[model samples]
Target: MAVAPQVLPHTAISTWSGFVYQGKLALYHCLKLMSSDYAANRDLKLQLESQDDFAIFRRQQCLSMHQVKAYKDPRFSAYSDGISTQRDNARQRGVALAYFHVAREVTNVPATFVADYGPVRFYTYPIPPDAAGNVIQSFCPLNQVDMFIRDELSSLLVNAAMQPAWKNYIVANIQNTLEAIVNLKVIMTHSKIHESTRHQTVIAASEFIEFSELYDVIEANDYAPFENEAFFLSRLQIDIGTYYQEFCERQDSLSQAACQKLDDYLAAITSLNVEGMKAFLRATMPHKKGRFKTLSEFKDQSLDRDAMRLGMFTIFWKLVQTARNDGSDVAFSWLNDGLFYYPTGIHHAAEHQESICHDIMQQAISEDVECLFECGALITSAIDRPSISDVIIGIDATEGVDTAEHELLRENRIGNYKKVAMISLNNVPESLKDAEPD
Candidate 1:
């Protein structure tokens, strides 16, 4: 029954955690339905006859019912009065009963229940130690279950039934019960398969009717929450081969939908350009060398387009410092076509419309005059004390260098001139001294 949009409907909290919890509950119920229905499909009915967390079952002509418990914690406490009551209830109701827990460690069966019905068995998790290094206390492994059940049933049959045909029927019923238990384990382990199968079952059940209306009808009838579980079983029976193929297709579609939703969620949080800018800054930033000169230097000041300019200035200062410490001057040719060299004239002529290198350098040089002055001091100390003429003329040249369009070309040429000047000022070689006075 489709709900009318004009009518007020039931209200519920809209939260992701709620969705997750509800989905898990739905999956649990669905698995239970599949387990029961699959047993019925095999000509055996394992009813959901218990309200507590247990699988209670009895087969045709069988003298014993089994209660199966699957749980996380493995430490089994002593048999409680509650279990004894359940056992008495089963006996009073004309059914013999036994109980088993899935994990290792279980209390001893009540002596009265054993005398009245049969021995309680334990069906545990696999043999390998779990995360906490504890093996489940199983009556026997799955491989051993067949022989174990057969032998136990034989003992029960010795006095319970004397007729051959009746004994055979009871044995067959025990086999059916074991098969159901095995199938239940398989379903629990491969939960995805159970979930997918259940989804198809629910969808098929609601094909011609709105699920909400169907749910409302079921609730109004005072039936169980999943009243239409049998409906899904009927739907699954129609062409199971087709149903499996459709299930694979639906699984593929779900994978695609999940990926697209993830992409949409990520795109909603961040812009493409912001990501690109971050990439640029990470690639260009100067890496570790020396410790910072001041605490203020530890804070990031590069947040905008000027970040690249600041990065270059810092790198240039480091280069100058390294050269001074090594007692060697760097050749201008060494920086040719390198990251620090700025050739705006050539860049502009090529119609490359990105941020110009010369402009970046001008901004960097103008803003970091203290760093430039320190570099000049280091350069002077590394070579020789500058003469009055050298100091006066060098400052005049430095002022004009930042304003030039082809700053790298001029800078490289000026480096060659400085090298020549240093050689002349220190020691004029005999060959050059004898040649001519420039």
Candidate 2:
């Protein structure tokens, strides 16, 4: 009887981080093979299974040793020269191994492994150390794998564009992969992929399918509150300045000392000093006898208190901007009381069109802006309705809203109700005061 030809499985040997790269690489190759007849011609079928911290690629029935005992054993170190020796031994036993080193410096592996075991690929995932020279070990490996996938997909997209059938198949599959990742039920290491890369990949896939629309909806759902709060704050800042200036110009009774105090109050507000703002209000606009018997009466008479009340209209006007900007078949109009034609019909529109809207909002929230929750709630009430129309948001709210709003109104003012409605911000609706973002 003739000896059988020993079939060698394609093996990837690396540490935990390297397993991430291996998994992505295997997925990429699997996609490539499925999109063409290449794998069928070679009688090969690549299947991938994700374990606890690593991934394994199964070719037919043969299971790689790294997947079973090696990855689990804490004593098993990838840096050891034994890795190279094992690779050599695998080669002799009709198995091929590719070793990936996570770090730039390879210490345990000898020069002989470098010379005989083919080129040792080093994946240097550059993660900057903190002020104390300590690395964030959790993010390092994920970052490296993300960088690898981003580069691979980018190159694949460019090359796939040449072949129509291959392009269509790959694009569809990549879009599906992205959707799956986004809709993942549980949080995993893969969830921490860089936001920029995710957006780029989504945009790239959108060119071939309606994936961007879906991605935009997902992004808006995730970051709409933060984006709305940022917008509301920008509008309120302007409203506060306008009210303060108007009050100072009209009131001859406002002394130089009072003006200085008002300036200090503005600064405190800008810096997000909540206690300082409260203190200023209490000290300068406290309730008095006779005419000002209650805090509400004092608030009505005081310029600073009036300005605070006037700031509520900023939320109203921002929502008006949102409604008017919405490209819907149903017309939108602001009533005399600063309420829209269909107040219940309005919906929150995403402020930014960039795929990185979530990241932008995350950064904004991290800055710890004052009244974030309140502003977000007010904006949410204006837009979060059951019957919402088509919303079209095309402004960079991170920049000054005045400029963006002017340009937006100029371009998209057609078919909208043009009646200007002016209302005192002090008389905000009780419903709006009670509402919150969902």
Residue 173, model 1: lDDT of: 40
* Reference-based TM-score of each model: 0.21, 0.26
Please identify model 1 stretches exceeding 4 Å from their true place: 1-42, 49-64, 71-82, 107-438
Candidate 2: residue 60 Cα off by (Å): 4.6
Clashes of 2: 1
Which model scores highest in TM-score? 2
Per-residue lDDT tens digits for candidate 1, residues 282-360, read 2222121222232122222322223222222222222211111122122110121221221010112213212222222
Cα-lDDT of candidate 2: 0.32
| CA lDDT, candidate 2, residue 386 | 19
Q: Please give the range of 10 consecutive residues that has the lowest summed lDDT in model 1.
A: 338-347
Candidates in order have lDDT scores of: 0.29, 0.32
lDDT of 1: 0.29
TM-score computed on alpha carbons, candidate 2: 0.26
